[model samples]
Target chain A: MAATMNDVAQRAGVSVKTVSNVVNGYPHIRETTRARVLAAIEELDYQLNVAARNLRTGRTGIIALAVPELSLPYFAELADSVIQAADAQGLTVLIEQTGSRRERELEVLSGARRHLTDGLLFSPLALGDGDEQLLDVDFPMVLLGERLFPDTVDHVTMQNVEGARAATEHLLGLGRRRVAVVGVHPGEVVGSAGLRLTGYRQALEAAGVPWDESLLGEAGLWHRSTGASAMAHLLDSGAAPDAVFAMNDAMALGVLHELQVRGIRVPDDVAVIGFDAVDEGEYSNPSLTTVDPGREQIAETAVRLLVEQIADKRGTHRPRRVYADFRILERRSTLPA
Target chain B: MAATMNDVAQRAGVSVKTVSNVVNGYPHIRETTRARVLAAIEELDYQLNVAARNLRTGRTGIIALAVPELSLPYFAELADSVIQAADAQGLTVLIEQTGSRRERELEVLSGARRHLTDGLLFSPLALGDGDEQLLDVDFPMVLLGERLFPDTVDHVTMQNVEGARAATEHLLGLGRRRVAVVGVHPGEVVGSAGLRLTGYRQALEAAGVPWDESLLGEAGLWHRSTGASAMAHLLDSGAAPDAVFAMNDAMALGVLHELQVRGIRVPDDVAVIGFDAVDEGEYSNPSLTTVDPGREQIAETAVRLLVEQIADKRGTHRPRRVYADFRILERRSTLPA
Candidate 1:
């Protein structure tokens, strides 16, 4: 059986109330009495009931981070960063995987676990139209990602369009026309895919290159396999391109692999660039060129915003939106250094 | 302000006690009354105070999964599997990242958050020496990985030695004379690195190939960068190896990238195999060949054992040690099909 306050009190030769006072850090206790109580508690290994204490304090000292899934290296690394940021503030993080599903994302915002966590750092990938009002909750929450922009909640996001534009312009600057794009979600207007596609079109217009629908490689989920399949589809459809702009690094790596499998040389036959400079890209064959989306800044800013809301307690602070700066990281996949 | 039981009662035209009964799912409540209470709850968006309910039931519908960190692909994939398994059992998982540090690992077992979770699924990477006594906690825990073996707790591990041996033997079967191993932690006898190195040596001895210490690539962490550097070190030391056995898939991918950078052809020049069949391996340049350590089974079995302990309530069930089966997944990295 686990030790209780009564066990500690009995071991310390004191009353239950005295032991409780010592455990709760009451300042009126004598030094000798506190030391004896501490020794007894350590000897018995008594644990204070955090749930009961939470009822009085209205704080759980824990935060929830809701991401799509950990299998994706981006989200996994983001979760790692959030945990480190939270740890610096002396808070624990609980992770929730929404699987990029609409229903699960709604359930997360329903405040079902509000009693257990002070606030949440939520990144919604499946919430689109008609989900704005649902984002407004009584509990403290800081939204992560470039999804919804509800004025009632704080949001931390990256420079999606600017970063993607920079990546596409980097390819165009290398004198590469007929650039192909991978991981395009048809009809998307707000998510990463849509914003990035817009940037690609802008870059093409600036370079006086015509936009060809044939060069757009449609893919779903943005996984590596999907990227490879998309590349195959583009090639099989006879859309010969001089360059490829993959939406993310995972897909970029996949595209590189597919090209290598076909014996097509990178930067010589086709140049490739991706967004989200994940660690794997640094050691990939040809060393992938990608955009660094300021993941660390996003993690830190989201935690800071969530902590602010938690401290306000009244939810009266006007919701703020913060965007992290991004940069292009040039590597061998684009051109020879 | 959040809605309370009184607000729900007022909206439903019922007493607070009746609302409480309906919320608690009492069978004695009338259907119409229950429907009215439920309607009020839906309209007001009221949530039950889970903390108070947990105190009464002595259970929290939440479990914790503690891993080294999510940045590593292996641990990220493992966390993904565990989350899916927990979801199937209708349990929510709260993740804790220990950063693979000994102090943090000890803190996780110190029962600091015991009141907030019903059980813990711990995968410690740094706990060693005299830390077995710390594993004897009063809470329900199922240890994951091969880091520790305590008689008092259930354990779920992969076939580290056997899997590594199969990988080495596969490379040797390709008529490769000198086999190099990556991600070796020297003079260790327990962890994954140590056990895998042992398997590599055993395979060499069984095949009548002399053991060459020069081919053992020392790496602190089994990350891709480390793996690439280890491969570089082996090459710089003039170890002309025909085959390489990387400890994990991430490192194997790195080794492939390193070899490609040096204009070395895979399979024709050096055959490579890795452990941990990660998803990224499927899309690598040569499509990595690795050992499938039954990750899905490990996740499912660990959750089953943990749920059983939670159900037992009295902690009377004997502990169990389960080893997931493993198999060699031959791909292009090994040899021509």
Candidate 2:
């Protein structure tokens, strides 16, 4: 049987309340008593039952992180960083995959599982501006990604537009006209794709290059296969682009692969750049030039904000929006040197 | 205030027990009564309190997945597959990062937080065979990766040896006599690295090639940076090999990057192969030839076994060791054609 508070108390020849006070770090306990209780607890190898303690304090010391998918390198890296940051705070993370489905995301918001976690770190890919009212939950939550809701909940977001603009400008500065973009979600106006598209257009306009509809490659899901197919379609249409900007590194990788398969040399024939400085980009053939969206900073800030919110018993703090910085990581894909 | 069973019962004009039975999908309820109860539930937007239910029944419908790290592409993809497979069975996964530390891995085994999870899907990188006694925990757990125990718990493993042998033979078939290996863990005997090294040696013997000690590159961590460093060390030490096999895809990618940096042409100068057919391999420049260790299958089977163990009221099942099949994916890295 697992050791109990009573067992520790008996071992220490003290009252259960005294042992509890010691365990809870009560300041009133004498150093000698605390040491005795600790030694007893150590001898028994007692682990305080977190679930049972949660019932009393209403805090499980667990934070739920809901992401679209871990298969995506971006989210995977983000998760890794979050877990690391949370570990520093002595908290464990519980991951939930919503599969970027509206129904599933909604379920996560309304589900009773919310009580099992101290707070939630939600990165909603499917929930849009229309679902803003759902953010008004009783529990603590910090929103992630580009979906900007009303300032009713804390949000940690990447500088999507700024990052994309930098990437597009890098390609345009390479003296390449007719720049094409892959992973343009059709009719998207508020998500990462839409924001990046706006940035791309802004860069093109600044470079005195007119936006061409023929240069846009439509992609619903930003998977490698989708990126490959989109690149193939762009090539088949005979609308040659001197430069290409894939929204993310995965798609950028696909574009590079497709170009290689078609005997088109990167940077020489078509300069390419991408967003999300995933580790995979560093080793891709020719390497990838990408916008590093300060993923570690974002993860750290989100965890810090969420932990603060969880500890705020008064619940009087207003929601705040924070954004991470971005920088272009130049590599061989965009520049030969 | 959230609606309770009593509120639902009163709204449906039925008893609380009947309402609970209806909510629990009791088949004996009449169609009219079920409809009325469901309507009441809908009207109240009632959600089942999983925490309250867990307190009563000690089941949270949440399984914990303890992996070494999510930053590694292999573990991230494996986690993705496990989450997908669990979702299909209506189970949610909680991820715990052990950071590949032995103390952390042991802490996970004895942690109080384990009570919050129905079972654990543990993928240990730090804990070795000597820690087998720790597997005697009361909770249901399915072991993943190597580090086999004495049949104390269910284990899901990949065919590391066979897969490595096939990869080596593929390079040998290309008439490459000297094949260098990357990501060899020092003093490993039964782990994935050790098993793969054994397979490499077996293939060398089968092909009548001599094993050179200098050809082995030691890597403490099977990460891309480590892979690059190991490859660089090999190159600087003048250990020239016609082909290279990295223990995992991340390391292979690093090797490829290093070779490119050194102006060495892949598949022409030194053929490269990797284990673990991660998605990154598919889009890598020259692409990557790798062993597909049936990751999805392993995940599905692990989840199935875990779920079964969770529901095993009799607790009569014996520990089973299951291996997933492996197939060599012929990509551009191994063969130019």
Output the number of the TM-score-best candidate: 2
True contacts kept of each: 0.83, 0.72
lDDT string, candidate 1, A164-199, tens digits: 889999999988888999989899888888889988
Q: Which residue segments of model 2 deviate by more than 4 Å?
A: A6-17, A30-36, A313-315, B9-19, B26-37, B313-316
Instruction: Write model 2 residue lDDT over B32-117, tens digit each, in one string.
Output: 99999999999998877666677667777888899988989999999999999998998888898888998888888885666688
Cα lDDT for residue B25, candidate 2:
87
In lDDT terms, how accurate is model 2? 0.89
For every prediction, compared with the true complex, DockQ reads 0.74, 0.67
Q: After superposition on all CA atoms, what RMSD does each candidate show versus the true structure?
A: 2.7, 2.3
lDDT of 2 at A330: 94
Off by over 4 Å in 1: A1-44, A148-150, B1-40, B148-150
| Per-residue alpha-carbon lDDT of candidate 2 for residues A60-138, written as tens digits (9 for 90 to 100) | 8889899988989999999999999998998888888888998888877875576678899999888776778887888
Instruction: Give the candidate number with the greatest DockQ.
Output: 1
Candidate 1 lDDT over B130-197, as tens digits, reads: 67788888888999976646577899999988889899999989999889999998877788888898
